[model samples]
Target chain A: MTEQELVQRAREGDELAFAQLVTDNEKRIYNLCRRLTGNPDDGAELAQEAFLNAWRGLGKFHGESSFATWLYRLASNACIDFLRREKRRRSLSMTVSLDDEEEGRQAELPDQGAGPEERLERAEDRRAIARALEQVSPEHRQVLVMRELSGLSYAEISQVLGLEEGTVKSRIARARAALRKRLLAEGNFFGGASSTR
Target chain B: MCDCEKALDWISLDLDGALTPQERRELEDHLAVCPGCAALARELAALHRVLPELEEEVPEGFQQAVMERVRAEKVQALPAGRGRAVPWRRWLSLAAVCAVVLAGAGSLGRFWDRSGGTEPAAGETLPVQAAQAGAAAQAGAAPQEEAAPQKEAAGEGQGPELRLYTAMADPSGAREAADSGEVLPEASPLPTVGAAMNQAAAQNEDLTEAQRAALTANCAAWLQTSGLDPAEAGLLTVEAVTQTDLEAAVCPGEDQRARLDLDDYRVTLGSSDVLLCDSATLEVLGYLPTV
Candidate 1:
């Protein structure tokens, strides 16, 4: 069944249906949270919170949108909400490390394990991208992350964010420009690959 | 038309296949002759190919973690029996986890207080109670006596509180949400708790509109200036299907289907049930038959 169908069923007090959704998209959503929050712990928490919120709010979900879109909305809001709370609010910086993330992605990547040197190199690139991302506005960062990390189409992004598609496109374009600028300033954007200006 | 100016416009429209046939022909003609623009297009295409890179990978056992939490929450949903069996050590660990998760959903806490610890003093039956109870049961998977006890507490008519998720430090954050504004996306968990589930709270549409506007502005300001990365954020395409046909502008071709078209937005609120709407002012603009 479609994601929306699952949501409809779950809203009708179906725990199994909600559980199925948790199984189907948990990995992607978890990973999306991890990348955005930059900490496995926070990502895990946010993912859990989103699911809980989704399960509780399922009945209220209107089919005016796709279930994924609705889930993404909850997930995004969960992240924002998490950042606002005490005890876990660490300047919005995550306590999780990218090294551990590689160990996790290793599960899905072609190579289960990479040499330390290769892994370290990948980690550094990730850090660079993450740091660059940290410099942009949250809206811009959201658009970039949703576009780059969540792989949402412009239309989907627009729907999830309740913004016009032009706004989504413009923000993404600007985010790319900003990330390019920051990375360039750091002299790490094109460390090995030459970028044609 | 192949010149950089028109080329840029075409690039945007072409990405969505919105260009007319004649415009497509002219744009292609320009692409064929313009080497500089062609290189730029190639670069853009390459970037498009890597669009997937923008999305990232979740940590290991992310799902396991979610399931563990969900299971733990479910246990919490159980009556007093669930937590009585939770060993102290295990309970402590779960307690730590629950504290963290609930913090992530501040709306849950606020809602619970508004509804859980109190009832409308003069025999007011709240229809929104069902939403709160269900959420309390499902998400309140906490220590034993999960959500029921808290809501039952509210039902007994005691004090209540509402939690705000924002820091409200930004100058722009000063404005309260328009009670009817779409900015209050954080209203989800509140419904399950006391505040959101209480349709009576929603009865104050003026208040809701104000709150909604303020919340939207608060989020917008954050979206505009905050440096924090978003876990997920995107534009949503909304397609509006009118319940009535008289004044509704249905998209061509689809007899029973209508697209929720606004100025550059299109969504088909096709199948999902709408539980509540303060007003049906969701006016539609043009029709997107394709959508």
Candidate 2:
């Protein structure tokens, strides 16, 4: 049966059909969570929560958009809410201080060469970028993940997030800038405006 | 250096391959003169290239875990008592009435047909209508003589404030209906906009100011999820509504209307436009352009 048919059956309380639907979209949804939260454990938990929400909210899932699109929205919301709560907790407790010069110096890159050192530094850069992503505001992180990680086009990101294309465009630009600033602060990248975290 | 800001914006867009040829050319021209922008563009481009590597594999047994939860929820959600049984019978009868009214009353029928014609489900759709049925049933059993006593009780502060505030367009008529003690019928045939508006407005004298505040907050939260600024929602007029009012306000298509549940409120965003949102989850049902 088609996904719409599965969705219809699931709407009428068909668990098997719903499971099938879940199997189909699990990877992307999990990845969406992982990218959004920057944690594998949180991604697994949030992805599950998103599907559970989808099950409870199946009645609400009118086929206005594709089921996958709906799942993305749900997954993104779960991750965003989790991040917001985490942010609040961090703010209250003052965790993850950015001023530690030791931590900041951890990813400092050497000038260009394609040696083993460069490859190792590139891996650190990737890890640093991922870490920097988590530090960006949830709103920016969300659009960034949708654009870069989830591979959603601007139009699709607009659709998934229910934003205007123009808004999505500008937000992605700002999100990139935010991530870049974070990377610069971490000393992962060589050149950018000299601003401290 | 004046062009640096614009160049940076273009560079971000350029990473996504979003820059137009002319824009790209302009960026290149600017980059040739500006070393800072050139370096920023190269780094941003490289960052964008590696972003996809961040995509993680779905952990083993992920689908199994999700399915396990889904099965658990289904078992939990299936009504244990006669709760599910009662709504099904009531919904069938109501659906029949809705079918007849929709077929015979051309405009109103079309309105509801577009409004998804009231799905006979266990969740979201049934609960509100079931509650409406319960309310109507109580009102039916109560004598018209009790209306006077109730009004007196309300006057003496024994009841909630009897002030009628309907989100309907015809405010005066709503006041009149409330005075006459007209509880909107569950799935009643509404022929005119006035009557339809009446169908939309079911006065809850018992709904507290706190409850209304909660409903407004729920809508504002849902509005945020719907990609609307909560401040924008604050500017719109809000009213607590049952499923009937939700249907009336969100008379777009079946898909949109099916999202509303019991106690969803309508936020009148414009004279003709409104938003329907579930109170509990604060999920936006849809935006409606009600005529």
Candidate 3:
């Protein structure tokens, strides 16, 4: 069945139809979450919560946009909320150690290159980039992730973020500039170009 | 001015294919002559390449976990009486109850008209009547003759029993009764339901659990009357119960106040139909067909 047909059936309370919808978009949603949260476990949980919310609020899906776009909006909101709450908790408690968090994140990066030396260098480059990304503000990071990672069109990002198209374009441009500047400052981009690439 | 700043501006847009063809040509020509701009563009391209490769895979059974949660929420939202068999009998009982309450309300309207009582303002009638009935019942006085028909209707027990009482004695009558320690009669289920929903909606809170259940039940009753099968048509799940402003065009005049005012719960079912219900009386004020 077409996606619209599946959505129609799902609306009619067909569990199978809804499951099919989940199956179709799970990877993209999961990847989006993984990138946003920078943690696989947290990404999985956020992705699941987003789907559950989508199921509950499915009636509000007016089909003015594609199902994937609608789902992206929900997943994005869930990630943003999670990040906000985490930020608040960290600020309030002051118990979370940044070094420990970075160590945990380092262990999560995949190690696959032509050889051990190359792999180690690649991992270092990955860590540097990730750390730089973490330093960027959430608003800029979000637009950058949507544009570069999720590969959404500026128009699609505008709809998902509820921003004007011009706003989306400018934000994305700013995000790119910010990210590049941060990587450069950290000596991860232009400084060690030969080894990093 | 040097074309360098403009080239930098166009770099990200060029990668995104967002630059105009003319602009793209200008940037390309600038980059060819200016090795600095060309190298900057290359670095931006490399950053784009690395971002996507960083996304990691989620753990196994993620889909299973999400589906499990969805099933659990669905089961919880289903009415207690829902069974393997369709709920036609329950629908019938609901229909019968609605008929009784509506009939009783019509009769009460006629009674008021005959007694030379004007129709009270939108906010006035129910609270006043409730207070008066509470006082009269507490005093051990029999309800006036005008309430007899409604009392008989309540005795049938097929639907929500509306307590008949005098219209508000005055604008502040209900408040006065409350302050004086006069117990207000238990409001008939309909208006109390309406009042509670209106209060919650005004605060923009999600419906309380009881209110959510009532809304689901109300939607079921409406689907039955519309000749749609709640179970088969997927109208069973109450996705949302929210209060929205009624457009004057959709609901006109006093009818708008009756139907669209704070008293209406906009019940969203599954992914389709939206039913506007009078929170006070469980009346389906407006129905938007499933999209």
Q: Can you write out model 2's per-residue Cα lDDT over B1-291, one digit (the tens) per residue?
A: 328768767887888788889888888898888777777777778788777766656777888888766654431122212211222222222222222222222323222322222322332222223323322332222112222223212122111112111101112222222344433233433344223322222322232223323434555665566555555332343334544565455433576567565435444552434676543333356766445
Q: Of the candidates shown, which would achieve the greatest DockQ relative to the real structure?
A: 2
Docking class of 1: incorrect
DockQ of each: 0.11, 0.19, 0.16
Give the runs in model 2 whose Cα sits over 4 Å from its true position: A91-118, A191-197, B77-291
Ranking by lDDT: 2, 3, 1
- Winner on TM-score (2 vs 3): 3
TM-score of each: 0.47, 0.51, 0.52
| TM-score of chain A, model number 1 | 0.79
Candidate 1: interface RMSD equals 5.5
- B168-262: candidate 3 lDDT, tens digit per residue: 32222232212222222333344455555554333322233344345445667767876765753223222123333354213323674554553
| Global Cα lDDT for candidate 2 | 0.57
> Cα miss at B222, model 2 (Å)?
57
- List, residue by residue over A110-181, the lDDT tens digit for candidate 3: 555458786766655666666667667777778877877678898899989999997787777778778878
- For model 2, residues A66-177, the per-residue Cα lDDT tens digits are 8889889999988878877887777442123232321332334444666997766666666777778877877898888888877888888888999899889888888888
Q: Go through the candidates in order and give each one's C-alpha lDDT.
A: 0.46, 0.57, 0.57
